[model samples]
Target: MSDNLEDLKNNHQDFSKGSLDSNEEKNPYVLFGRWFDEAIASGELEVNACVISTVSVDLQPSARIVYLKEMVDNSFVFYTNYSSQKGKEIAINPKASMLFFWPKNERQVRIEGEVVKLPEAISDAYFESRPLQSKLGAWASHQSDELVDSSEIHNRMAYYSDKFGDVVPRPAHWGGYALMPQCIEFWQGRPSRLHDRIVFTSFEGTWKIHRKNP
Candidate 1:
């Protein structure tokens, strides 16, 4: 193992004690929102970042960091290139997992669920709200493709810049995916490596909350 890997393996972090009250159990979405609010208030770097994991048809898993754009109606929403590898993977198999870890709060949340394409109107509205540079870059770059040179990317940017000018339209190959979580597991740190784990699993129109072994 590398020196850094050895060092990381030997290192340990003790979690603070925090309990999720049982009475506060209506929706897991609300609990996640509350935890997200705390993470935001703690001022962690890129607090909105989440690790999205997707599996291909062959069951190979891939993960990438993506910024969480919104959580609406119990679904986590993030946008990316619909033609990217992840997009293609989801196209073939629409199941995905998401992880949110807040080092400062010693909290981690894992979610597993099915992915669904958002409405085109939702994508268009979000696309129009983006900064012009981002819009142009989105149109210019082909995600998950091999690039020969930086100059090619620059030329593509220039080409798109000239083609679309100021008002760049959202490409059909780019939009959002909403993960409808079937299970959400919340972890809180405690002393001596012992931790609190609470999981909510969705059933027929209801969620069953249970405590998990730490």
Candidate 2:
């Protein structure tokens, strides 16, 4: 009751955490690794959490938060049910974008490119390593589908729990997708709204670096 909307609107914090120079590493993956490590060192929570935006076949854009599982061969990897909304969207249009923001460090990274399903072996390995309950949940939840009642999930979960016992196999519908970025832009917030934006775009087999207006 004591909070004032006017006071909140007037408050602003100028970013000065860090800067990205033009002479930095040319490989976006290497640069991402460095920033990721720095974020971890700075004690940022859930550093791998990122927003993935996918456009439906009808041109409707949807965004959701997903955890970055790994980076392999310069591709960002994450896992989910292939029957989900995002999965269906990707099937229709392989083009997608991912956004990572570390508010504590005043930094954000935006990547755009084509997404492809990862190898089944890799997905199986990661799936096997997950906790038992998660494996059961994966089997129980029919992602992005309508449920008649809330208890349906719990009922399916209990059923799968008893059926699997131990050593649950990864469902064929569940797997990982890798986003191979064509352009990656790193943004470092600066004072007075003059932020720094550096982008790396792929051309042929090489990457071209460029600076963009804030």
Candidate 3:
């Protein structure tokens, strides 16, 4: 392939697709829902995809993509193995952030919050709704654990399949997490590399909305 690094280094695209209205609805949740709906309408793939960032006890930060499953009482809910890297990090430090980007709309959302594990009942309900393979995989994979061989996981999967038969239950090590937002920032791309950012901060059980310099 030809060298494109130099070309890529100089390429730039001006963003002018949208701008956040200062007088728009101040409730972040309401605004998020509206933006999410618009993303869906605009045919953005994986509209519910979000990046979850967590920090280990050593202050090392890690980010991974997770699908937003639901919202519970204003918390963003997502599921994963409790033994995974992110899970363990959250256990050490509950402080986390989530990022939702919709390049198609020239918009992104940054959410800062503390995460808590969802109740087992909620996790069970979601697990029951998953496809059979997913439920089985949840039991087979020892998340975040070092594996000497790839085949070991498949072997474990086969064993779980044979053992559980047609009814696989959610593993005890897997569950849901709810991120309760303390600060939410909505960003809209504008021309001249200047963007619009609206921030909603929760204080004393109420949201304080304001604008931030881009």
Candidate 4:
């Protein structure tokens, strides 16, 4: 046990990949776009993935990874089953936090904001673009529910496949939600633990920018 603890404590890496100056950029969304492009150029997997945290009615926090589908009107959008655990939490709380970590680039972005369902037309268009199998699977799986066995899901999948053929419609329970960020903070890793931090806070349609100590 002592050896394992010592090994864990010694496993450290110094970061010097990038730096961010709060004075250089006033728009968090613009900086986020550049960082996202660089991450894609670096050839990392799942660049759009982010961790979403939601609070239950009882104040318990739950977090899971979801893909960032789109950003429009200053809101980040993602799709999922409305019956999922996170969806239920959103129903009661109507707010969430999203974290994006690009380890290869030694950068992370934290966003906190209110969540609202996307317009039905947008969800319909996106759903129509999805592959036939994905549309079928969305109908087949009851998200966040206990499964009796693998066969149970497989049976459901087969049933949906036979029922929908090649033209599966989007289920009413599955759609997109947009997170309107009230605060966005960008972190760029630096050497000697002196990381750079810049935060943008929204107020009455204006953004107040500031820096934080590392």
Work out the TM-score per prediction: 0.94, 0.95, 0.97, 0.95
What is the C-alpha lDDT profile of model 3 across 89-197, one tens digit per residue? 9998999999999989999999999999999999999999999999999998898899999999999999999999999888999999999999999999999988999
lDDT of each: 0.89, 0.94, 0.94, 0.93
Please give the lDDT score at residue 74 for candidate 4: 82
- Deviation of model 3 at 186, angstroms: 0.2
Worst 10 contiguous positions by lDDT, candidate 2? 1-10
Residue 209 Cα positional deviation in candidate 3, in Å, after optimal superposition: 0.9
Q: What CA RMSD would candidate 3 show?
A: 1.2
The 10-residue segment with the lowest total lDDT in model 4: 1-10
Write down the TM-score for model 2. 0.95
Could you tell me the lDDT of residue 206 within candidate 4?
A: 88
lDDT of 2 by residue, 1-214 (tens): 5467657877898999888886788888889998898889899999999999999988999999999998878899999999999999999999999999988889999999999999999999999999999999999999999988999999999999899999799999999999999999999999898999999999999999999999
lDDT sort, best first: 3, 2, 4, 1
| Candidate 2 deviant stretches above 4 angstroms | 1-8
Lowest summed lDDT across 10 adjacent residues in model 1 is found at 17-26
Q: Please estimate how well model 3 matches the true structure, expressed as its whole-model Cα lDDT.
A: 0.94
**Deviation in angstroms for 211 in model 1?**
1.2
Candidate closest to the true structure, highest TM-score: 3
